[model samples]
Target: MTWRRALSVALALALALLLLLVVYDRPLRLMPWRKRSAQPEAAERRTNRGPALATLGRGKGDGVDLFKGEPLLGEEHIFFVETSCALDKPQHVPYDSESGLRLSPRGACAVEAAAAAHPTHRVYLVHTCDVHRRSLAKDAAPAYALAALSIPNVRLWAVPYALHFVGTPLQGWLASGALRASRWPVVHASDVLRFLLLWKYGGTYLDLDVLMLRSLGEKKNFGCAESPAAVSVGAFNFALDDPGRRVANACIAELLDYRPDLWSYNGPGAITRALKKVCDVQEVLEMTEEMCGGFRLLSTSTFYAIPWQNWNLFFTEESSEEIMMMIGKNLAVHVWNALSHNTTIYTSSEQPYAQIARRVCPNVVAAVGDTM
Candidate 1:
């Protein structure tokens, strides 16, 4: 009788242990720490595969190529905007196609320089006009744009304004046709688009004329001051996360009081006004990152090392070595294309612009042999 009782006790202990294991298995696997630990590994895998392009939205019959995978936009992107009719109508400038408008050599040089300077970051050449891939075939697209696109990190894309402005504060204003009625339609449109782009998909925005001199590094949510008093929207950075979104939202909101008749009202003016909402504009000049809620204001040397008033310096024959020394620590040089568009750059000439092009955008310099 004692031996039989011992056998029953052993069997009961085994059954109780098995029941506990069965009950805890699923819950243990579903713990919060397990999911938290998996996120970093997944992100690492995506980064190792290199940057990929994804289609955001496309209309019927739109010839834009849909890349089909990866995130649409992120902190790793650097964007350049082309808002003029230059994509469809010839600007009679260097690299302009006889059949249609194409990217200018200077523009291509800008894109190339950015890609070369920041190999890890993806550079996007965004056009406000409709772009058909068929239109970008060998004969239609200029050699400069083609050469720039050959770089692994450079991409050309056309995004619709309506799609970009959808959920933002600019949506109702854009839908009202106020943009069409503006005296400076192209200028105002460019301003509106920049703010909207930053608001939706945060990243660095550079005017097509801005040339990158070095890696932008991990700088996020910042703008360059054109002078001691005001910030320039020509080159700015806004991250894709929460902090960036807040400042971008403020800039978009300022557009509600858009001034169509004023030239700088929407572009530089909007950004300055937006900053005023959070802090004293004068304090921004002091270079404090915490001034406007983590928004840093870089000095004039960073982007506008050569101001627009001195735009002629780029084309004039000067000491290339001295110019380089002046802007050596500068992250970029804004060529002030708005004021310097009429000026011509020749390969045979040894001007500051030509010299910089040879070093930064050698491929473009080689493509457009004599002039740019």
Candidate 2:
């Protein structure tokens, strides 16, 4: 009787094991523990990888990196320049705009959106401040993990570190006898890097201060007009291997030979000057909404609805609803931090900046303990 009972138990166990193996060998997984982590695995991959090597213009002589695999250039990308202070932690905390770019709260939201916006496209936040940057606040790296989320499509490109041992396009300009570092602000470095990225890797370049309310729809090669006919360099995109890259190349060349003429000499001014020759339009105001030399020209109302001079309206405004309604057909809005840096983003009560900040970078706001 005892031997029969033990044989029965062994047979039952063998049957269960055979059934499990058969189920697993079929279509569906037999065990829940064996389920694959698709999203988390992809996010992990994104954290490790950097930008796809720009193959078109950046030949061996142009200083392209040797090891990084050239991901398809046809793949879409959204690039942002953030030369942030290393100590600026808790990225959502409100610091003086005059201090630097909105690296925390605003930047966190912008990067999150840009990465998630185009599900397939890659987003690069170029941290170009290698060493010379001054620390404005405390450690923001921990809080940044929240903003960055497990964004599989986003990459934080530390420019100097990435190109440390490799040859880069900028080395020529840096090595040139005429180049002077004295006149260049670290901010100007942003401009130089922006132009270089656009020229090398065909994609859109956005300012860290800009925010997008929607995904970057269908990608195209284009620049937004700040006013009626004046194009702003703040938001622009290009198709891979587009001829428009030449315009960016010319701008970088001018940036190499830069002088402090106009405040925006290295930025908008350089872009406008290049477009004037290519667009063949004598009056910038005369430039229409249509394509200019195979490039889409977006109007200010479609992008920069508020002028830089009127930046105060964003802060003092009483109602967030009224301001949102006024955004109209804009693809995105430029915060114009350069003018509004000193303006307070928070107030005793609900202010426009706070409302916007809460909606976009909620994680940051919560981390910083901002009153809702």
Report residue 342 deviation for candidate 2 (angstroms): 3.4
Clashing pairs in 1: none
**Reference-based TM-score, model 2:** 0.67
* Each candidate: RMSD: 12.9, 16.8
Best by TM-score: 1
Tens-digit lDDT track of model 2 for 176-200: 5322343434455566667767776
Q: Least accurate stretch of 10 residues (summed lDDT) in model 2? A: 131-140
Off by over 4 Å in 1: 1-75, 85-101, 280-287
How well is each residue in 60-123 modelled by candidate 1, as lDDT tens digits? 4433333222225553878877766522332233534542435778899999999999998778
* Deviation (Å) of 164 in candidate 1: 1.6
